[model samples]
Target: MAEQLLDVIVRKRELQGDGVVVLDLTRADGAALPLFDAGAHVDIHIAPGLVRQYSLCSDPADASVYRLGVLKDPASRGGSAGVHAHLLEGRQVQISAPRNLFPLAEGATRSILLGGGIGITPMIAMAYALEQRGDAFELHYCGRSRNHSAFLAELGSAPFASKVVTHFDDEHGRLDLAAVLGQGRARVHMYTCGPAGFMDWVIDGARQQGYAEDHIHKEYFQAEVDASGEGFEVVAARSGKTVQVAEGQSILQALTAVGIDIPISCEQGVCGSCLCDVLEGEPDHRDVYLTDDEKAGNDQILVCCSRAKSKKLVLDI
Candidate 1:
């Protein structure tokens, strides 16, 4: 279905210690919002010039309200800063329907959740889902400090509190990566979301502890593209259109500039909403959203952040 941009009114705002601000929004038209699952996120149209993706931190069953937390990033590309500076209670915003790429698999024996900084957003919702199903799980949250952490109170009071471990880098030194992944548990699936460095540490440490790559899952909140050298061209098969995508302009942006409507959620390439089939040409595949096998098979490409390796490429879109 085509994405519908709905006007959402800010119901409330909460300062979750740290530079994070949680904004709760409800449909301005008072219509029923779409149901979402754990690990789901929505693309919020915060203003005329800004759009950002935030993981839903509220209960999925609470269809009447949508909740999101924004960290005031000083180095932000204007998105988070705009939300914090311009958004307030009772303000109106636009948001897309919920979309999920990091879905929990069914029939898992045990689950382990690791979150860092603001990456705790999706993990928070996963904790709720795991609790409702009475599943065996563990949640490890790491941050520079408790004051810089979001949702500390709710996480502390959650039913899974006993299993939740908080690590403050400032006081407790670096996270005890060895001890956490070395619990020697079998048949346990691990899910993580955090900064690239933190995620790298977790993934690398887990591998060192004999965890299979298939057993480890992760979600990255940011993507850094090194568009230093050159530009490329992308040809749309159906439209018979070719666009010169500069090093700074992503294929998705170029397509959109020419009035092609492509589904996109997280422009960072964490969400798989912008995935499209590649009829021909090699893709640079910079997105973390797709599995290695998926990329090797040339089945799909995340146009939002990925570019082309071939000088000329064709897209099924």
Candidate 2:
């Protein structure tokens, strides 16, 4: 992963609103960056062992630079704060190739994009792809206020501006979810990214309105996980080794302590980089990356932020 990282230079930085900042990065050697699809994200190596994932919000057709919209989180674990403080114009940085976890559904006749607050970043790129395909789509952006929303001017000036509807809590009151998603029809798909609570409301609304689970897509930046639990034994079947996972420790930490390495990014369980297969016991799934149906399968686990429910488990390793 280290050898695959691309060195980039920050071309510009723009303040979107109160706590939001947008960054434009280009190849340090004046070459075109790798082409990425809409809803793709790159892992930025902010500092040693400090990697964070951010979605690309720029137009996919243009390979000149990759744009990212970041919110300065007051409760950041150093990702957002570091970017706002040190990721300045002309600064060189390293980032991973783009990876997409929230891809658009193929052959959908209608698409609905719901972006809340800083979540509008990915939706902007998605809008570009949808418009280019000449597909019917609508973007509904909800924010606390106009001053707090990032990329308002850009969204308003976009060619698809007529298809965008914005709702501000301070101005337009609440966005009626029921009205926006009245009935889920065939060939209609929905995508959402934002706070967990807001996402839950939209997802529940969509489900109640007859939308299939596969037709609804979402991406979570972080999840509230309780990784602490009783100690257990993890058997690495391939390596022929066993490690005791102590209480208050994750499976990933325990394995790494014994020199078993698993590539990881976004330790909060959002990136799914450390996903591993389980051959034996049931896992207490705490990550939001896996859907409820996937959790029910119980064949795999996200070792980074998930613990075992069984006392002893066998890993495919």
Candidate 3:
């Protein structure tokens, strides 16, 4: 909701790797899009009621176009499937201005970029920016295999190719997390994105290596939490209705089940689409949308992935 929606045209589409499709999008009006830094992402409107957030994979310096890589998962809820099936070149699409939550550390002496599977999207942009600035940086990309890895050719030809390392599970055996992050990484700020388990493993390794939390930047493609039933009550102050948020469900689900419609997207918590005002009670802020300071205030919450820490929550719904 921070940026207005714009129409963009899919200029090109190509297979980046197994089940991954790369889309080259440009303004439908042939105008330059908003400038964005590395690690930025745009909310893509799939259907009237379906929207998803995808990281910008192209170089930030290039304002003429924005590139996104999407993984077409067979088990997904149809976001990527729709893109793969219908979002072909020349198709028109709706998107919001790019927003960045996983930005590089401004003061780090060295930078380490870790990517896994389709998570390489943002890392590619970061690599370009870091290389352009002549910063001390290295990129380590991992995947199940070369066939399933996206953008391998691009990474190999990157300006910082010499600093790029590849680790394919089929060939390299499960990543030697400790060895890759063993030493010297303490001085380098790290930025990583991937599947929940993969990112968690990488983050845990960094923490075990004594990396400062502030220097370890991460973004989750999906929420990784036991959102199971811890029964809680929600007091919808606006509607004057009390609802029981059962276990194994989200706050948003509880509201929607009661016919309380809320604007939401990327239920994973990465996008700030489901943000709501909290009139009372403490919120278990789990979403990546809000900053630490914002979470501390407990005045707002992203209902999609957050829950009530207190027994009852008074929401401005």
Report per-prediction Cα RMSD to one decimal: 2.6, 1.7, 2.2
Per-residue lDDT of model 3, residues 1-317, tens digit only? 35579899999999878999999999999999988999999988988887888999999999999999999987777788888988989999899889898888786688888998999899999999998888988889989999888898888887788999999989977878777776645468888999988898999899988888888889877665458548799988888778998887888988998889888877867778788899889999888767788999999998888888799999998
Report clashes for each candidate as comma-separated counts: 0, 0, 3
Candidate 2's residue-wise lDDT over 225-266, tens digit each? 676679999998888889999988899998999888888877
The lowest-lDDT stretch of 10 consecutive residues in candidate 3 is: 220-229
Report how far off residue 48 is in candidate 3 (Å). 0.7
Candidate 1, residue 82: the lDDT equals 84
Q: Please, what are the lDDT tens digits per residue for candidate 1 over residues 1-317?
A: 66688888999998887799998889999987888999888887876646788889887767898788888988887788888987898898888888887887677788889998888889888988888888988889899987788888888887778888989988887888877777535677788988888898899888888887778888887876544436888888888888999977889888999988897655777767788999888888888878989989875889888887788678987
Off by over 4 Å in 1: 5-7, 29-33, 183-186, 229-231, 243-249, 252-265
Answer with 2 or 3, whichever has the higher lDDT.
Answer: 2
TM-score of 3: 0.92
Q: Candidates sorted by lDDT, descending order?
A: 2, 3, 1
- On a 0 to 1 TM-score scale, where does candidate 1 land against the true structure? 0.88
Stretches of model 2 off by over 4 angstroms after superposition: 1-3, 239-241
lDDT of model 1 at residue 79?
Answer: 81
